[model samples]
Target: MKLTLIFLIMISFLSGCNKSENDEKPEKKELELKSKEVLEATDRFGWELLQAVNKEADPGQNVVISSLSVAQALGMTTNGAANETLSQMLDVMDFGEVSEMNEAFHNIREVLQTADPKVQVDIANSVWYRQGMPAKESFGEALEEDYDAAFREVDFSKKQEAKDLINGWVNDKTKGKIPSIVDEISAGQYMFLINAVYFLGKWQYEFDKSATKDEDFTLSDGSTMQVPMMNQETDLDFYSGEDCQAVKLPYGDGSFYMVIALPANGIELDEFINSLDTNKWSTITDNMHERGLALFMPRFEVECKFKLNQTLIDMGMELPFSEFGADFSNMTEAQVFIDEVMHKTYIKADEEGTEAAAVTSVSVVVTSVGGGGPMPFRIDRPFFFAIAEEESDAILFSGKIENPKQ
Candidate 1:
């Protein structure tokens, strides 16, 4: 008989934009071979994850998520998986091999953290296990060496103390943008693998605060509400697609950007989102060109929380969550499986730029779980947006704003 080990993993990501002046742009560097491959793979995975989550969301509801955070946390956990569990995770994430994935993630983290001196990007990882639980030495070593993860052995029986330790790290890493992720620790839960990312950068071109004014924002329901819309007329990387108008707003030193896409007048936000795929996304992003134009977007904030177990199962990653069939023996001597995945996100976009944060927590009782365009480009209606790195085009955060006020 296999002894079941319950594991919980929490992944959190945070990004902030403040007003600043940095006239110099960072020099573009060529991506290494492994970095390039992983970027493409993760980008594909990110899109698929976004579409899946959107499908599960309520009609007209807002959604924001950090694909990088989810990938990092799961990537660390993948080190412990074997057999079909490993294969399914690799297939779902679009990764080629384990060694390649590990090396690539390490390289990408290095590149992203030092991408621009003007921008601040921090990535952190941790491993927490029950005080006496036996875990594979190789598993912990890989996480520490490849992902720079910090390890702590805690008394799981002391639930409140363990919870505080984990949540405190999250709060500190996110600069208090997200106060806590683990609400309570269950009895069967033994270990947690976590990843936290924090990013802060200013816009290359800040919107004038004086120009922001009350404007009508059209909701998905066709109702309209007054919102503080920021207006700007400047040169920006713009794309005119058959389905939507898109623009890329660069952040500090041009190493990062926020891409916003507004579906054509008659198209619904959901319809446009459903039509998006990796192929279309690449083509649209590749075609963007700098152009001078009038731009209007509301200064708004959105917070979203979701339980993503069924979503991942629907996406063809079911074995790891299974109680009987799950194989995480590579991680520990005991049989373990995932239990739940919880994701929460917050974003605020204004004239200064955009500030966003997300936390994706996977609880393994062992179970678990688990963009646009432009125009003179008025975003008066519901639209999609993403924060990404310019070099690899890796999406750090992505979401839709149905109504900014909500």
Candidate 2:
């Protein structure tokens, strides 16, 4: 009952995902430090995810890697790196003392610790069904007012107090990186999960806008589109040989970078992604050198939302949301457990740093990257991407591009 009271209190101040764009911006590597705890937590999670991608992905598109790190999330000028930390954590239903998973939960709380107490309560967030279902019933009267319905009522004309209060708080923290906190919610949702993000960044060397060109981009399906590609010839960490096709673009001070792994011709994209290993990731990072190279980036931003219930089931970690659940007895007794889990994330970028965050929740119901390789993978078309921090290579966001339409 005490645990229920605490969680229910959190659910009141919840904020659902305000999905944003994937707009790309110009940024260069620079020197920025991160909390050591955040670094270890992020990398360990990223490593675990690499292990999963190495096993489960399809032949052509099996392993996709991308990230947004704490540094990048908190940055003002450069994207953190390919973001992968959160995606892996979402797939796992139980932590089971695994160092990475444990560290991950710790890092999340660490970030939360920095937030204002009112901010935490105002979000009224948690993972569970809210309609007095068997799960939400634990809270008695504390758990009323569905966050989803509240989101629906937030019209530009007449906004709900809950939504406005939370969004304003997030905007202030992120320096406007996250302008809107609640995009949409439903009456049937069991839990109201909210994640706030903040970021600021600048390019080491600003792009000469005059050099931007409307170039042809060959997508995976052999289709082509005209995109404004930011092209620059600079000294970069480049590697090319029989085993790989790749390059690393540094932002600002050379402490962080964006690495692209291109698949070799004739090899299936999914196969290359699925066959990924830590060494392959290592090679991309290890072989990187400061050399003269050409950089081409399309000016584009994409925002998407997806129901990932099926995707999580496909992964190996499947115990908590089920009748066989995570043991949260430490929080309270009375056989309390998670019911359902949901996750929502958003990212946006351009000539500079990336601003992104992921939010996930588990109820009486439930809840829950990248790189490289031999024969060189060319991501000229649809491919996996990540945003990572340098020291720990903490990935904050991760996703696949099988059919962006969905």
Candidate 3:
């Protein structure tokens, strides 16, 4: 099995939105890439969100998440929002306007989906609503054309079947890596919008598994555990920061790479994570240059699951989840609000390559907050990692490994 990680975010909104887009598919048009300003904004949003959700991590526990999945799902949710609800969501997401963010998301997806032939990056979006829910025409049109999302009518009252069908779609999109995203559909959840991204890539320079050996991985509390260590020494883009060290490991054609950042000894991982910003991130990756250094990393896996309603609220997106204060009139004529947002991610890294997937589900009834250098980069303790596209600088998946043994 290749080093693989899967991330899933399930957002459950309480209110339902628009109807099916017309059956006929429109002629394809070449989409433009996101502007530098918007792309930078998107990157900043990811980092800020990383800080927000990092608050939920437990001491000495691993946490990994997909910022792309969260942004895509919430961006889709913004389409049907209006008034204060829309404003707050946009502010929290750091998006200027719904139209611009929609385009940015489309462009980013387009670039990533077609980045390289050797690497497989697929992003799929869909909407499933209870049969007879009267979602608005404008809302449906936006979702169809702007987001390129498929629409399905389901009997949400038949909770079990509805849950299974939605979960099956996510499983299929993630290549069966994520079998199910929804275990239960609550009483008032009239609709669900889901986005899934699956990525598979081979290391530009593969590690020799034959040289792998068990080594000691130190924990934050000074405890240690034995883990399979993979060793490689090549001229890789490396950077050293005031508080951390980082390196970029290219994948496939080098359009995409995994950047890992390890905190300097004596710097707490949480302290470093809290202080990270776009400037700090840029300072590290921008200063990176090809340097020959010994790289020793543990081969490990991480699975993180979270309910993001509170995290988002903490990030200044409180109105959407407020059952009484939300305004989703653009989606439906009735009173509606978001309820909850759920996220789950899984990742595994070894010698050959890396494979990862993420799913973001938004239920209308309710919800949803929601990188590095290299140096001798011995990631013996807690550290962070991000997989991103070089051109757009869009972060696809990111996480912190506190203790891989768990």
Candidate 4:
């Protein structure tokens, strides 16, 4: 008999400007930097994951994923991994060593959750195991102490009850943006590791709704569609590269930002995306300077869902999903392997601001796995965007916008 372990991750971001005259921005303390390497590794992993998912998506389909959410879930799961399975997971995530990974993640969560007083960021983790399942003491301690996860015991025999308990937590964390993630729980599934992230921030500079008007937006195939284009004029951090032009839209005192990159005329979106790498990304971001600009962007909404089992495998993380080759002795005495990795996300951006949410679940019976800016920046065509923090440069959410109507 084989037991399964399931992991679920959910992340959400909500943005809008509702500042009153009496509202004064509070002075926020500087976030101490301790995990520069972990930040870099996670950002690199984010780019790679986005590229991989893009390769598998149909043309013109918008894609979004929360890299931080996925990393946190996987980081918790890695506590139980051993031998080749452990090494493979670490390598795929670009985590060079395990010594400080947990500490780094904990620090990251603390900083991100409290980065900006005006912004509301919440990160929560929990573990639910079958009533009789014997999870190692060390593993539980690592989750509770390092990851700050809440532990519970559920009877898997009552599948509906189990589903409600897990899904209820996901819904609560996301503030109902994501109502549920668990549709069913099989008898073989013995445990679940879940991570949920929620973010809500008002724009530092809000767009006037009255200025929004329908405008022509060019499609990838030389076609055009009319979209509700939000217009604004202000000083913004901008970048002009050989292949693309970019802009940064700060949220709540500039600790977090949304950066948008539009491909230059003659360059296809796919072509530019394929060319993106860590070095190129650094160059683009590092070169940005404040410039007075006119900006036009569409009010768009995007939702994406993906099963990342094959994607992770293609990225060289294989053994954890292999039934016979897998080893998770550190987690439990039971012999188990991953079953699926489910991810879902939703984002809505309007004149007031943007709201986005994501959920990723990995079942090890189960196996699973798992932004933006601006400019005169007329986003009149398909472009890439990311939501990231200034201190850590940690990418919380990222995706491409092909059509606002969809």
Give the range where candidate 4 is weakest over 10 consecutive residues by summed lDDT.
1-10
- Relative to the true structure, candidate 3 reaches a TM of 0.88
RMSD of model 2 against the true structure = 12.7
Candidate 1 residue lDDT tens string, 1-406: 0001001101111122342323232232456798788888887888888888998888888988888888888888889899999999888988788878887888787778768777777777778887888579998888888888878888889899999998998888777887888887887786777777777878899999999999999888878899999988888988887799899999988988888999887887888887777788887789999988789988888878877788878888899888888889888876778777777777777777666667667666543331233336788998998898888777898878888888
lDDT of 3 by residue, 1-406 (tens): 0011111111112223342332121212233544455667767777887777888777777777788888888888888889999999988777787888877776676667666656788888888876888678898888777677888889988888888889989999888877777877877776788888888998898889998888989888888989888988778898886798898999988988999998887888888888877888788889998878779988877767777888889889998888778888888766667776777677778898888888877766733311334346577887888998887777888878887768
lDDT of 2 by residue, 199-236 (tens): 23344555667887776666666777676666666666
**Model 1 regions lying over 4 Å from their true place:** 1-30, 366-375
> What lDDT score belongs to each candidate, Candidate 1 first?
0.80, 0.40, 0.78, 0.80
Q: Is candidate 1 or candidate 3 better by TM-score?
A: 1
State the local distance difference test value for candidate 1: 0.80
Candidate 3 stretches with Cα past 4 Å from truth are: 1-35, 366-376
Task: Report the error of model 2 at residue 24, Å.
Answer: 30
TM-score on alpha carbons, each prediction: 0.89, 0.57, 0.88, 0.89
Clashes of each: 21, 103, 32, 34
Ranking by lDDT: 4, 1, 3, 2
- Candidate 2 global lDDT: 0.40
